[model samples]
Target chain A: MEQPILSIQNATKIFGGGFLSSSKPIVALDRFSLDVYESQSKIITIAGESGSGKTTLANMILGFTPCTEGKITFNGIDLNQMNGEQRSFYRQEVQAIFQDPYEVYNPFFRVAHIFDMITRHFKLARSKKEAQELIEEALNLVGMRGGEILEKYPHQLSGGQRQRVMVARAYMLRPKLIVADEPVSAVDASLRAMILDIMLRLRDTRHISFLYITHDLSTAYQISDLMYVLFQGTTVERGNTAKIIEDPRHPYVQELIDSIPVPNPKIKWNMNIKLPSEEVMRMKNTVGCRFYPRCPKRMDACTKAFPPMVKVSEEHEVACYLYQ
Target chain B: MAANEKILEVLDLHVQYFTPRGAVKAANAVNLYVKAGEIVGLVGESGCGKTTVAMAILQMVQPPGRIVKGEIRINGHNIVNLSEAELRKVRWRELALIPQGAMNSLNPVLRIREQMGDAIQAHEAISARDLKARVLSLLNDVGLPERVYNMYPHELSGGMKQRVCIAMAVALNPAIIIADEPTSALDVVVQRVVAQTLLDVKKRLGVSMIMIGHDMGLQAQMVDRVAVMYAGNMVEVGPVESIFAQPLHPYTQLLIESIPSIRERKPLKVTEGLTHDLRNPPTGCCFQFRCPRVEPRCLQAQPAMIEAGPEHLVSCIHYQAR
Candidate 1:
């Protein structure tokens, strides 16, 4: 039997804009929903530009912030109603990988201390010998040795090594899901592949779901099994990674896909690239669509009310007036 | 010197950082030249010495990190031996730098107009009225609105701030502009605009540019020529078209293959192992430890860069004619 490991239903995160506040409410995320099944481990990438609320969604998944409306549940347990014991267990089941590897670790402490804390906090080992064994196993999975990295400080290890250590720590916990927010964005080009490769291995071997968040479409297409294209807190497109990458539908998605500089020098970009307009659409007052102002194929009704998600295929759905 | 030839040239450049642990050879015997109105890309991963070469070109290499050997010539003048006072005259007027972080580059306490005034006044004796006009004209070239001139850095968006930096770089009408990861901090949409802005500046001013970036995709789009660096050495140099289509060096081949393209969906063929540590770099070839097609000679001696195709130079022992 298959059950959803994580389910987000109509999650909305609104910052400010109430009776007490004079500023307009900024809708960081609006009615976003997603699901991950435990029976099938996959990488679900949330792709968006800056201010597109991808980080907000990742923070929601990490349980750092509660959605103002709707709910997020892990293994049938709602986040808004979890007890202290349940919350602790939820923390153990879900781990996070951050963007900056340098900031993740404390410069004063030995790098091995992070893994030790993970094992002790999660109660993964009963004795010091068992903890050492677990640490070695996790390190081996990420192509690192406990002997080389154990006694070293954070500064001693390279950027790639520090990021791999984070992966190793996540592996030690045996988490059901890992939320990696721009995991390789700060790392160098040569090292990005190694970190991404580790994530793929974790998915294949450990059967763990990864909620990946990034602005880089190339990397998103490389690792994601499924992808969601967000535009200003709204899910404009969602489908299998290949289908979406091959043929993007929404105007925003199309622009984003076209904007990526191709590695082939033969194909040069013209000066015809579109810049995002500065026209602000007040969410509270306006309705047709959140992307109405910047959307290339926007209709008159697109400015009247929010557009609904329309089914394009069995595995694809897009929110736009074009399909309708 | 020939008319409009070689705006900037760096020959046998070597820069090293002397730390308490050891000497980190950041740039080793690098040779590069930028022709007038051409954009040459210096592509490499972090710590591969792309930025070091850019800094050394402008004599911006700080203490503990000095250029031990090199001839950096700007219009045939050896800038490497120029004094501080002599260098100042050629600094912004002949050579300019668009630094990495756009937001951090601006003074938070100062207004945009005041910052621009400082840069313009340092070079030429311009009045306040003339400075404003000059700054506005530069900003207009980058497609920035006049309102941004009076605003603080905090008031502008990341993309707008980057435009300000671009405007400031070309304020003195320098012949060469070295942009280090100009669009790395901006979003894809903003990056495209900033990139287009760079192209516009290059076209309008006819100033040669050395764009330092790790993204090969952006490099392919913007640069006329490409140079690939590994550990501190220039592993490959060639026309952008030739290098992208048929990379001769193993390191360049691996780098081009690693980039994830939107046009195709193939598993990234990643080369194993991390980059070499500068303090204890390997003899012969820096990429020998991680190269897939490394030969015995690769371990013993560093291969000299040999011409593989028209305008294409590669450094590898096992590269054969195709």
Candidate 2:
């Protein structure tokens, strides 16, 4: 079998823990693993609420932070052990799309400076004309015309247009994987569809796998192929997107799916449903299920230790003891 | 006031921002009303002037921007021409506001009790004991614990702080509360929780509300009526069910079609034209540049709001011709 393009094995990231400090260490991400194969390009969604460590996982994969344990390998090369040259290659192969498009650009420069910087750093083209061609082609991929946006300052473009330019910037790198963190959350409804459509088109045409990180499961359900539903930094459920959204098994996953406000007015949320306080929800259980405090179906067995992932179907796995 | 009585009415409102280049017509002849206890949603893209309209209602539009021509009536009293001192008397007691990014609205140094107390104390003459009781009850109404009263704003979570804002907005039981994107910043689960709190408070207090947001899904679930805005113009207004089920205006149709759904996956139907420059809007229709059903007549004159269905109003040349 061909090796996966990117593989993460038992990656753990714990923040602020040393011999000198008295405060307990916060486990941002605990033993998370995922794989993206080169043969098929896919949009894999890492979904969870705030502080569920979706961004932490993205940070580790993007080399923004190092894992406390385990390893992340890109095409069989461990990320931490990469030399300067290998690191550059990895950087080119992996790009990121942040949440706020407005803050990403420098206000002093024209929007074209983003593309010019990338091309200059990578030496993507030798001549000015060649560089222009590269930038135009990238813009075209995201359904934008370079002539309309290149000369304008960042403030001139709307939120949706700025985000599309960001997508074009990331695509220009020709990365194997794009880690998009809440790319569409800041845009409007119509433009959000456009950006998500661009991502779908990129996956099919460019063969670029995407690690889409978002708190919105509705959009994730629309585009992602595979999904990992995280609860307090632990993978509560992992499966095919359609399967998981259609038949979510874990208690936390079920609650999440139910909480999403459906667009149709005919479908209303159950108003009687109450969530636990933030204090209880954020309480960490070091030796047991993190969701135990808020889980309606929690039991004594759950508090004994963190449940292992058990296969519910060929492509679906859940970490609840009910499945055990 | 009676249930069907109009608690708040905005008629022929025009708000403009005078920039160095030109006057940006942020709200052009906008018209909307809220019946007692009704939750009317004002939704549009970022710069569609939804927030501007909310600020106009509160009489809070700052310099370079002003309510050029309009009449905002709360309980039959026009607030647009009211003096600063007169308006302050009408503000929290009659027409309150839960501003956008409400989590940051609270002073970080002040405890929730002191902050909420100040709003009440400014408008009323309650004793210290009575004020404390009133604040605690307000907190309880929003499902917040009593302990939250003494906690500083920084100590509360985002959801908690938002609930505090909601509690504060209802402190005086105002006739109408303008909530500007009340749940936009929170996570999905927490957003739903805050949304539910809003609904509960409205139902218990019988206060009318105007919710401003871009999230159609949340609007569908939370609001009684939905008003669609495009480029500083009111394009469509109808009951929430009818607006979602049978959107009339071209912009409304596109907006509804653009909302991504969780029930099933479908091809995204996005309209492709940028909103026209607000400073130099077209003569006939504000959405003519992007309207799929645009015609020459649409550019000849601005379409007036016509009755499209039972209690549904749409501003489009097609309906006007009919």
Which runs of model 1 end up more than 4 angstroms from their true locations? A276-286, B1-4, B319-322
Q: TM-score for every candidate vs. truth? A: 0.97, 0.98
Candidate 2, residues B1-322, lDDT tens digits: the string is 5678999999999999999999999999999999998999999999999999999999999889999998998888888988999989999999889999999999999999999999999999999999999999999999999999899998889999999999999999899999999998798878989999999999999999999998899999999999989989999999999999999898888888887888898877766778888999989988888888788888987788999898799998888667
lDDT of 1 by residue, A1-324 (tens): 666878999999999989999998888888899999988999999999888899999888888999999999988999979999999998988999999999988899998889878787778899999999999999999988999999999999988889999988987888999999999998877788888888998999999989899999888888889999988888999989888888888888988888899888877776686555343533332356777766677778787778899988878899988998
After best superposition, candidate 1 residue B94: deviation in angstroms?
A: 0.9
Task: Report every candidate's CA lDDT.
Answer: 0.88, 0.92
Global CA lDDT of candidate 1, please?
0.88
Tens digits of per-residue lDDT, candidate 2, A78-167, equal 999999999999999999999999999999999999999999999999999999999999999888889999999999999999999999
How would you encode candidate 1's per-residue C-alpha lDDT over B1-322 as one tens digit per residue?
Answer: 4545988899999999999999999998898999999999999888899999999999999989999998999888888978999999999999999988866889999999999889889989988888888999998999987888888998888888998999999999999999999999788878999999999999998989999999999999999999999999999999999998888888888888888878777775655687777899888888888888877778877788888877788878776333
lDDT for A153 in candidate 1 is 98
Deviation (Å) of A240 in candidate 1: 1.4
For residue A72, model 1's alpha carbon misses the true position, in angstroms, by: 0.9
